[model samples]
Target: MKKKNDENVLATNRQARHNYEIEDTIEAGIELQGTEIKSVRAGKINLRDGYVSIKNGQANLSNVHISEYKQGNIYNHDPLRVRRLLLHKKELKRLAKEVDQDGMTIVPLKVYLKHGFAKVLIGVAKGKKNYDKRESLKQKELKRELQRNFKLNQF
Candidate 1:
């Protein structure tokens, strides 16, 4: 059987890192139904391709897929429904300000179980240009080569 941690991390948006340079992060609580919460606990959630949008001065998450519970039928929540995120008014204002800047966005980084409750790690990020992404890739390759050379010399 897998470890407990395997069932804890429901999903992570890997594209968030590659597509944007994460500037800051904050944890937020999400409003979820009973079945949705159960589905998340069973590790049936996807954060990739999910995004946050502000409507009427409130933040809402969209495109997040939380699989239906095995036993849930009529009570199942929509897989891609927009869910509200719990944030302080001041924090929401700050996020709204940041999002108003060009190329900046609010994205969910990961969803995980915290003390029996589901929590989301949201990040304020700025989209990177093609050249910026290339530079990051180059830096990664250089780091890998340096590590390889050091290991070979040690052996």
Candidate 2:
């Protein structure tokens, strides 16, 4: 369902946060074929393995899967096709520069529909170390415990 802000989240890459420390996020429009957008609207899209690559001054989304529309015929789009992402020239240059840093990469955080257009939220991220991942887990558990205790005390 679309929110008051006119965004309807379709798919999220939950593992992206667990594996990478996001430095920044940018929203970019996605170019989808007719059948592909239909599959996306039906929630048959997966962003888990998607990443953004900037090449030839353009951003491309790779490894994302949008299943074929069940009702689509011979012109159905490819499920794992690399799609183009639309970003301004300045944003594209910035993203390209950010990705050139050591251990830095661009990952797709989520796919959502905004104002009738398909968009992808891409993040500039650095892969977390094993220790960093464990620390984050510990912090999450602590936060959960605190929330539970607070709720108990409220009653």
Candidate 3:
């Protein structure tokens, strides 16, 4: 059996890094039903294609899939429902302005339990062009090669 970490990370969207250039991040509380939280703790959550949107001064999380709990039976929540994100009004306004003016969008980076409350780490990010993605891959390869060479020299 796999051991769960004390840190309690439910899901992480590593692909967000490859697809977007994140500029700012904030922690926001997510509204979840009992079964939804159960599914999250069991690590059946996916944020790979998830995104955030602000409508009517409220932030909403979309496309973040939390699989139904096996034991939930009739109490299971929808796997792909749009969940409400709780944030300060001031923060919402600021995010809305930046998104409108900068053409950036919000994306969930990771979800975890904090102080027994489910929190999501979200970022304001601009989508990367194809060329930008390729360049990032090239830079990552260079960094890996440098690290490998340094380890060899230390031997």
Candidate 4:
């Protein structure tokens, strides 16, 4: 009963990796309406500006945009409504504790389908400083150069 293949990724937030150091990742289910799932299947979603916040002891994902379904009727949901995340109570509490600490936040890394259900991969991340970003970039460039040199030597 799966709509998307296991390898199909609906959306990803590359900026999350660039801006944050992800210490832990967790997969959680999402609450979506009928039209929302259609939109998600069509790959009409953005996770770049989305974040999960704990409110009233509940985890709510906000600012994630799921475009309106083209064939949706009047019952279509609001494109930017806050969606609830399905996670165990203990997990939620653990996340809350981490997020409560200084410089720790929750961010959505990607969205995909798992076993016919919409799932989101979230990360417990700490923000990277400007110098850290530059250092990471330098390391990436060095790795690329090493790979290129290796390929040329093999030829």
lDDT of 2 by residue, 1-155 (tens): 64653348888999999999999999999999999999998999988888889999999999999999989989898999999999999999999999999999999998888878888899999999999999999999999999999999999
Best by TM-score: 2
Q: Give the TM-score of candidate 1.
A: 0.90
Model 2 lDDT, full chain set: 0.93
Task: Answer with 2 or 4, whichever has the higher lDDT.
Answer: 4
In candidate 1, residue 141 scores what lDDT?
99
Task: Kindly indicate the candidate among 1 and 2 with the higher TM-score.
Answer: 2
TM-score, every prediction = 0.90, 0.96, 0.94, 0.94
Q: Name the Cα RMSD for model 1.
A: 2.8
Estimate candidate 3's alpha-carbon lDDT, on a 0 to 1 scale: 0.93
How much lDDT does candidate 4 score?
0.94
Name the lDDT value of residue 59 in candidate 4: 94
lDDT of each: 0.90, 0.93, 0.93, 0.94
Lowest lDDT 10-residue stretch of candidate 2: 1-10
Instruction: Report the C-alpha displacement of residue 3, candidate 3, in angstroms.
Output: 16
lDDT of 3 at 128: 97
Q: Which segments of model 1 are wrong by more than 4 Å?
A: 1-7
- Model 4, clash count? 0
Model 2 off-target regions past 4 Å? Answer: 1-7
